[model samples]
Target: MSHVHRDRKKLLTRVRRIGGQVAALERALQGEADCSDVLVQIAAAKGAMQALMIEVLKGHLNEHVVAGKTEAVRAREAEAIMQLLGRYAR
Candidate 1:
């Protein structure tokens, strides 16, 4: 899990930023901000979340798919991740 450990702080920071974006979205909704501005903020939050997912997926692939206890386990892990990615892709 070194991939994840090495980037823990960075990932946490990203998550925090996403949280801030969500809070901003909430405030904008409360204050009745312009539709375009609110949509942009929503897009920002969605992009941040997608980035986080990519990071975690990379770590999982490196740690579990590439370094599992056995070939069978690794294949299973990789297949599971691939299935999730397939769904995400759509």
Candidate 2:
């Protein structure tokens, strides 16, 4: 079974929390909050998103790369993940 399948609830909870953070950011903007407060909220939302990304990445690594049946499959998985990481970094 996939790691996500096993941990769906936990992952969904993270997603919901990130959504809430985004909603809070939207409200802050709509309310014409102070520039510094809005920036702080943006930072919080970014951090939450990054945390969710890391969680999903960890599941992908464990399920597809580390636990893959063959070296070629593992290498391919790792390569794909690295490519995504490269894009994300930019």
Number of residue pairs clashing in candidate 1, backbone atoms closer than 3 angstroms, sequence gap of 3 or more or interchain: 0
For 12-79, candidate 2 gives per-residue lDDT tens digits of: 99889988988988999999799998999899989988988998899999899989999999999999
Alpha-carbon lDDT of model 1: 0.93
* Deviation of model 1 at 78, angstroms: 1.2
**Model 2: pairs clashing at backbone N, Cα or C within 3 Å:** none
**Each prediction's Cα lDDT score?**
0.93, 0.91
lDDT of 2: 0.91
Q: In model 2, how large is the Cα lDDT of residue 38? A: 92
Per-prediction TM-score, please? 0.84, 0.93
Off by over 4 Å in 1: 1-6, 86-90
lDDT per residue for candidate 1 within 1-90, as digits (tens), equals 377788989999999999999999999999979999999999999999999998889888888988899999999998999899899989
